[model samples]
Target: MDGHPLRLALDLLKGTLALTVHKIRYGLASRLWHGTNLVTEQMSRHTQQVRLLRAGEVLGSLDVSTVRDEIGSRRGTVSFNGCLHQLFSGQPLTRQEKALVLAQLVASFSLTTSYDFADSPLLDGDDRLLMREVLYGAGFAAREMRTFIYQSRQDGQDTTADIESKSTREQTRSATRKLEVVDVSLDEFIRFHDANLAQKHNYRRWDIDAAFVADALALGKARILAARGRSADGLTPQGIQAAMIYTWDDISLKLYRISYDTAKTANPHANKVLIARGMQMAHDLGLLLDTDCAPPGAAILYERFGFPERVRTHYVRATLLSKFAAFIRRDFPSLDRRLRPWVIRAVTRVNRSAA
Candidate 1:
C-alpha cells in the first residue's frame, strides 16, 4: 500500500499539513510567546556538553570593534572572499580552523550589522541551531534579527572558504585567459548596469533598492560581477562586455540580473563566460543556481546548461485570468469571487517583486 500512487499522495499531503502546522506553532511560540530563550539555552547547554568553545572564546578572535572598523574603511573596496584570500594566502585550512574563522566572521558581522549571527542562512541547519544558542547566550538578539546576514552572504567570504581548493585551481588558470569575467568595483558595476543591462531589461529596475545595493556591495563585495570581451578587432579588451548581479537566496545563488553586449564585442562567449562564472561560484559555495526570470528563448540555453525547468503554471493561469478577469467578473457575477481576488493578489505580488 505504501508503494501505491494514491498512498504516496496521501503521505505527501499529510507531511505538508504537518509541516505547515509545525511552522505555525513555531512562529507563535518564537514570536508571540517569546520561547526563543528556551531553545537558545538548550543549544547553549549542548555546546558546553560537547566541549565546544564558549561564545566569548569564539567571538574573541574576530573582535566586534575590528569588524566595525573594517566595515567603515573597506565597505566597497574589498569583498569577504578577497579578505579571506589575503588572510589564508591560498593556503588550505583544516575543518576546525575553517569553522572557527566562519564563526568569527559571522559573529563580527552580526555584531556590526545588529543581526543575529546564529540565524544566518550561511550556517547549515544543525550549525544554525548551535550558533543560535551561542550568539544568543553571548547577548545577541534571539528575536528581531534583520537582513544583515543576507548582505554578509553576498560578500562570499564563508562560501569562498568552503571552495578554497576550487578557487586555487582557477587561480592557476588565470594567466592563460585573455578575456575573462572578473569582479568589478561597485561604481563600475553601477555604470555597467546603467549602460548595458538596464537597457536590455527595458530600464526596469531590479527589485533591489539602490541604497540596498550600495550597502550590500559595500559589505559582500561579490554582489556585482562583470566581464570584458574582445574589441571589434578581436585582439584587445572591449570594456564591460557582459555583467551580472546575484545574491544568495537561502541555499540558491539566484542570478537576478545579466546582460551581454553581443553587438559591439567580437567575443561570442561573453554571455556563456559570465554564466559559467556564476555556475562555478554556486558550485564553490555548495549552493544550487537559480534565476529570477528567463525568457522563452533563454529557457533552451538554461536547459543546455543543465538547469531543469518547471513551467510556472501559476504564471500561465494568472496571465489567462488577467486577460479574462473583467469578462469573467462581468459575465459571471454570481460565481465565487474569492478565487479571482486571490489570483489577482498573487499576481500583483509577483509582478511587483519581478525585475
Candidate 2:
C-alpha cells in the first residue's frame, strides 16, 4: 500500500506535531471558532504532489517516488506536512454535532495515511472499518466537500510555507484569513469555489471517502445544505476543528459560511471587509504559503479565491441596507447609531461569494 492510490492521494502529517489553521482563512471551521488564532498569516498554499492514499489515484502532485529528495524542499512558505494538515483538518469527523470532536482529533491521530496499517486506538478493528466506510460514502457523492488545506504560523515562525524549488520559479501567495469551521453541501461547496477559481492555479484530488457525507448526514452530527433549496444556513466558529469549504476551482463560490465578529462592526459588509483586511495583514507579513504534496500555489490560492474583494454575495435581508449603513458609520459609530439601519435575516440577489 506504499504507493497505493489512497496513500498517494494526500501527503500525511509529520509525526505527532500539532497543527494550527488560521480560522479567518477557512470556511466550516471559521463559523464554529470564536477566538484564538493559531496561524499568524492570512494565506496558505496546496499542491498536486500527493495522491489519495485510499484510492491510489494521483490525488496530489507530490508522488512517493520523490519523497526523500523533497522532504523539506522549500515551496513558497509551506511544507508537505503542513499542507496535509491544512486540508485534512477541514473535514467533518462525525457530523453528529455542529462541531464534532472526532474529526478534529483525527487530524493529529496519524501523521501518515496508511492502508493495511490499521492500528488507531481511536477506533477498534470493527469501528475503524466503519469509520472508513462512512468516509467512503461521503466520497461517492463526488461533491466538493472542501478539499483545500492550510497551516498556521509556527511557534515563533511566520508559518505560511510556499512552493519554491531551488531551480524553479516561485508560486504567488495571497492574504491569509484566520481558520474557522464551516459546512455546506458538496455541490454548493464546489460551485462557490469553482466559479471564481483562476485558470492559472488549482488544487489536486483527495480520493476522499464517498460515504463520508451520507454518514455525516445520517448521523445527524452536522448539516448539509440542499443543492436546490435554502433560504439561509448556519455553522460554528472557533479553535481546532475539522471543517470543509468549497474549493476555488468549483463554479459556485457562493453560499460558503463565514465567521462574523459582531463586535467588529454593526454593518455586515464592512465587518467582512475587516476580516479580509486582517487576512491581508497576515499575508503582508510574509505569511503566504505552499508545499510539496499540492501544486505550487495551494495555500495562498485558498485565501485568494476566498478574499473579501472577490466574495460571492447572496441577499441577507437588510444586509443590502445595513451594509450601506455600516459603511457610512465606519468612522462615527455614535452618529451612525441614530441613522443606523436595521438588519433583518432575509435573502435576495446578493453576491454569494464572500468570506
Each candidate: what lDDT? 0.41, 0.26
User: What tens digits encode model 2's per-residue C-alpha lDDT throughout 177-257?
Assistant: 223223456555444434434443434221122122233234332243211111133243222112132111111111123
Provide backbone clash counts, one per model: 1, 132
Which number leads on TM-score?
1
lDDT by residue (1-355, candidate 1, tens digit) is 1244456445434533433443444333433342111112111110110111233232112211111111121111112111111222123655444444333333223111222111222334544455444333333333322111111233443332222245432432341164666677656766766665444545443322343345445445237777774356876755777778776532456565676666643455566556666766776676656544467666555545545543211100011232244344555666637555665566556645752
**Per-residue lDDT for 57 in model 1?**
32
* Model 1, runs deviating above 4 Å: 1-178, 197-201, 230-237, 264-266, 310-355
Q: Compute each candidate's TM-score over C-alphas.
A: 0.38, 0.19
* Best prediction by lDDT: 1
